[model samples]
Target: MSEKPEPVDYTYTPIGTIHSPFKDIVGMPIQPTGARGIRGTIEIRSDLKGGLADLERFSRIILLYSLHRCTGYSLKVSPFLDPTPHGIFATRSPKRPNAIGFSIVRLVGIDDCTLTIEDVDILDGTPLLDIKPYVPAFDSYPDERSGWLGAVAHNAQHAKSDDRFQ
Candidate 1:
C-alpha cells in the first residue's frame, strides 16, 4: 500500500458573499463569456469596508471567490471547454483542494458595502475572498500561449459545466 500524506490546517473567513441569479448549476455559464451581461452583487462585510475605498476608480475588477458548493479534489478533469481530460491545473475546475474561483467582471456601481457587477458566472451565495481592480494594460495580452485551451477557447461560450468534478 502507498503511504498517505499528512494534512495541514489553515483558516479563512469569507470577506463577503456574492448574490447572483444563478441558483442552479444546470445550464449556467461555465465562464464569464457565456454569462455576458449577467448581473450580480457582492455584499462585503462591514469590517472590510475600509479596504474597498477608491475601488470605483476602475470600471472592472477581478473577483476572487470560493466555490463553496464544490468539494473534493482531482488531479485530472474533463473541463467544460474540452472533451479530453487534462490536468486540474490546466483548467479552472472548482474541485480543487482550495475551491477558489476567479472572474474579471465589469463594475456597475458600488452602494455602501455592496458592489453591482456584470458578466457573472459564479453561483449565488458564493463566498467572496478578495477583489482587485482590473487594469487592461497589466492583465491584457496581444498574443499568449493557451496550451490545450487554445483549441476550445473559441467554443467556450457554448460550453456548459457538467459533473466532472463531483
Candidate 2:
C-alpha cells in the first residue's frame, strides 16, 4: 500500500484587482459568455506590471480571481443558472472551499499596468490571483460534452446573477 502525502497549506497574495461596473451581485451577469462587450478594468500591482508585457498580443485572457464578497460555502449548492443542487466541484458556483472564480475576458487595450477588458462577469474590487493568455488551440474544445450543463446551457445567455450565491 502506498502512503498518501499530507497536503501542505499555502496562500496567495492578489497580484491585481478587477474593477467593474457591477458593484453589487444582484444584477451581474453570471459568466463571461453572458456578459459580452461589458467593459471593465484590471489594475495590476505596480510590482507585477512587468508581467503584463506581451499579454496584449492575445485577444483574450483568463483571470483567476478571489470571490472576495462571497462568504461561507456549501459542498452541495444550487448554482445561479440551475435550480437543482450539485456538488460544489460539479458546478461553477462561487461558494466553495477556495472561493476562486475563473473568468475569461476580451483584452481590449492596455495602459501601463491597467488593462481594458470586455465580457467581464466578476464583481468590482475582486482580488485577482493570476492571468493567462487564451489560445484557441489550447483552450477551446469545440466537441467537448458539458455534462448536466448541456441541458441548460442556453439559459446562460439570458441569466443574470442574483443573491442566491451571496
Candidate 3:
C-alpha cells in the first residue's frame, strides 16, 4: 500500500473587511435571500484598492470571508433551514473544518476601496478573503439536484440564524 499523504497547513491574509448590520448571530438572516435588500460595505485595504478596477461592472459578486466567530467545527450540523443534521459538506454551515463562508450579493456601487453591497447575510467585521464576479452562466444549474436541501430550500428566505452553532 502507498503511504498516506500528510495534511498541509495554509495561511491567508484578509484583503478587506465586511461591514454589516449584524453584530451578533442570534437573529441575523441565514442567507442572502433572507437578507434581501439589506445593505453592507466592504472596506478593502488601501494597498489593494487597485484590484477593484473593472470589478464594479459586475452586478453581483461572490465574497469569500472568514467565519471568525465560529470557534470550532462539527462534521455534521443542523443548518438554519433544516433541523436534521447533515454532513458538513452537504450544508452551508458556519461550523466547518475551515471557518470559511461565502455569499453572493448585489454590487450596488464602488467608491475608492469600499464597495456598497446589498442582500448581505454575513456578520459585521468579517474578514474578507477574496471577491469574484458572479457569472450566472458559470454558477447556475437550474436542473441540478440539491439533494436534501431541495425539500427545505425555500425556507431559507424566511430563516434567521440562532445561537446553535455558538
Candidate 4:
C-alpha cells in the first residue's frame, strides 16, 4: 500500500469584512433565496482597494468568508431545511472542518473598497476571504442533481437558521 501524505497547514489574511443586518445566527435566513433583497456591505481593506477593479461588471459575486462564530464541526449535521442528519459535506453547515462558508450575492454597487450587496445570508462581522465574479455559464448546471437536497431544497426560500449549528 502507498503511504499517506502528510497534512499541510495554510494561512489566510482577511481581505475585508462583511456587514449584514443579521447579528445573531438565530432567525437569520439560511440561504440567499431566503435573504432575497436583504442589503449588506463589504468593507474591503484599503490596501486591497485596487483589486476591486472591473469587479462591478458582474451582476453577482461569490463571497467566500470565514464562519468566525462557529466553534466546532461535526461530520454529520441536521441542516435547516431538514432534520435528518446528513454528512456535513452534503449540507451547507457553518460548522465545518475549516469553518468556511460561501454565498453568492447580488452586486448592487461598488465605491472604492466598499461593495453594496443584496440577497445576503451571511452573519455580520464575518471575515471576507475571497470574492469571485459569478458566471452563469460556468456556475449553473441545468442537469445536475442535488442528491438529498432535491426533496427539501424548495423550503430553503423560507427556511431560517437556528442555534443548532452553533
Candidate 5:
C-alpha cells in the first residue's frame, strides 16, 4: 500500500466579499431560515465579474464563503438549534479545520460586478470563495435523515446566532 502524504497548508485569495447589515455575531440569524428577507450585497473582484454571466437565469444560488471571524474549533459543538453537542462535522458549526460556510440564498438582482441577495446568514465582510447556481431538480431530496436535527428543527426557526463558535 502507498503511504499517505503529509498535510500541507493551502491559501485562498478571496474572490469577493459578502456585505450585510449584520455587523456582529450577536443577534444574527443562525441559518438561512432565520435570515429570510434579510438582504445583502456581494462585491466581486472586477476581473471575475464576467463569471456572473447568465447567473440570473437561476432564482437561487449557493454561496461558499470563509468564516473569517471564527477563531477556534471544537470536535463537538452545541449547534444553535439543539442543546446537545454533536460531532463538529455533523453540524453546521463554523468552527472547523477549515472555516468555510455554505448558504443557499435567493438571488434578487445583479448589477455589474455586484449581486443583491436575500436570506443571508453570513457575517458582514465574509470572504466569498465561490458561488454556484442552485438547481432544485438536482439538489432536492425528500427522503433524507436529519438525525438529532429532526427533533430540534422546530428550534431553528427562531434561533439567532451568538458568539458561541466565534
Candidate 6:
C-alpha cells in the first residue's frame, strides 16, 4: 500500500493591512488595470519598519496578499471578462484554494511605515504578504502570449468585480 504524503503547514503573520475606498465586494475593479487612478494605503506595523528600507526608491511595487473576502474555491471558473471556463491557474480570477492575490500598484509615497499607493483593486484590510519593486526593464515584455486572455483583449480594461468568487 502507498502512504499519503504528510500535509506541510506554514504560517505568516500579516505585516500590515490595506486600506482602500472599496469596502463592498460588488462593483469594484476586477484587475489593477481596471482600477487605475484609484488610491489606497498600506498600514505597516512599526516593527516591520526595518524591512521597508529603500522601498521608496521604486516607482511601483508588487503586492502579494490574501483574498480574505472570498469564501470558496472552484477548480475551474469563468473569469469576469470571458464566457468560457478556464483552469484556475490560467486566470487571475480570485477563486483559489489559498485565496491569495497579486497586484502591481504605483507607490505614491511612503510615510513612516505606511505606503500610499495608486491603482488599488484589493479589498480593504486584506492581509499583505510581501512587496517588491516593479522593474520594467526586467518585468516587461512587448511580445508574449496571453493564452485564453488573448481571446478577450478588450475586457482587460473594462471588467469590474463580481460576486462569482464569493
Off by over 4 Å in 5: none
Q: Which parts of model 6 are misplaced by more than 4 Å?
A: 1-4
| Candidate 1 residue-wise lDDT, 1-116, digit = tens | 99898998877788999999988777778888888899999999999999989998899999998888887888898788777988889888888878888999999999999999
- Better structure of 1 and 2 per TM-score: 2
**For model 4, how does the per-residue alpha-carbon lDDT over 1-166 read when each residue is reduced to its tens digit?**
9999999998999999999999999999999999999999999999989999999899999999999999989999988878799999999999899999999999999988899999999999999999999999999996889989998988999988889888
Give the clashing residue pairs of candidate 3, or none. Answer: none
| Per-model C-alpha RMSD | 3.2, 1.1, 0.7, 0.8, 1.0, 1.7
Per-prediction TM-score, please? 0.91, 0.95, 0.98, 0.98, 0.96, 0.93
lDDT values, one for every candidate: 0.87, 0.92, 0.95, 0.95, 0.91, 0.89
TM-score winner, 4 or 6: 4
Q: Taking the tens digit of each residue's C-alpha lDDT, what string does model 2 give over 72-141?
A: 9999999877789999999999988889899989999999989999999989999999999999999999
Question: Residues 12-89, candidate 3, lDDT per residue (tens digit)?
Answer: 999999999999999999889999999999999999999999998999999999999998999999888877889999
Model 5, 10-87: lDDT tens digits are 999889999999999988988888889999999999999889999999999999999999988999998888788899
How displaced is residue 113 in candidate 5, in Å? Answer: 0.7
Backbone atom clashes (below 3 Å) for every candidate:
0, 0, 0, 0, 0, 0
Displacement of the residue 72 alpha carbon in candidate 6, Å: 2.4
